[model samples]
Target: MTQKITIDGKDYAVGKLSEEARNQVVNLRVCDQEIAHLKQRLAIAQTARAAYASGLRKALASAEVVEH
Candidate 1:
């Protein structure tokens, strides 16, 4: 089966992709999606770590030193 694609008032023809091309295209799309998810997770972790560090610093500063 073939397909017709139109772009900017121009008509283009695309035929069925070969097996290798189909596999690679699908793999690339999956990899891109995985990368996007990982980046989002990394950002969330970094934000949480920063907030934790800031809280720790504040707690340490407010601690009273007891000389016994």
Candidate 2:
């Protein structure tokens, strides 16, 4: 088996690496309610950064991107 990994535009040899690299996104609670919580957070964050905070809020409000 030939497996290669490229990171940061550089090739890194897998030395003492894990046999399986798995990433798990665990949502402790339902995201629907979390969105409201995030909105409140955005409001607090927006006070410090108007433009970027608004941008984040806008991006979060929009529909999820479809990855094909």
Q: Which candidate leads in TM-score?
A: 1
Q: All candidates' TM-scores? A: 0.68, 0.28
**Candidate 2 local Cα displacement, residue 47, angstroms:** 1.0
- The runs of at least 3 residues in candidate 2 whose Cα sits more than 4 Å from the true structure, single-residue gaps closed, are 1-29, 50-68
Question: Each candidate: what lDDT?
Answer: 0.78, 0.61
Which residue window of length 10 is worst by lDDT in model 2? 20-29
lDDT value for model 2: 0.61
- Put down candidate 1 lDDT per residue, 1-68, tens digits, no spaces: 46654546965443555677566666877998999999999999999999999999999899986788
Global Cα lDDT for candidate 1: 0.78
Each model's total of backbone clashes = 0, 0
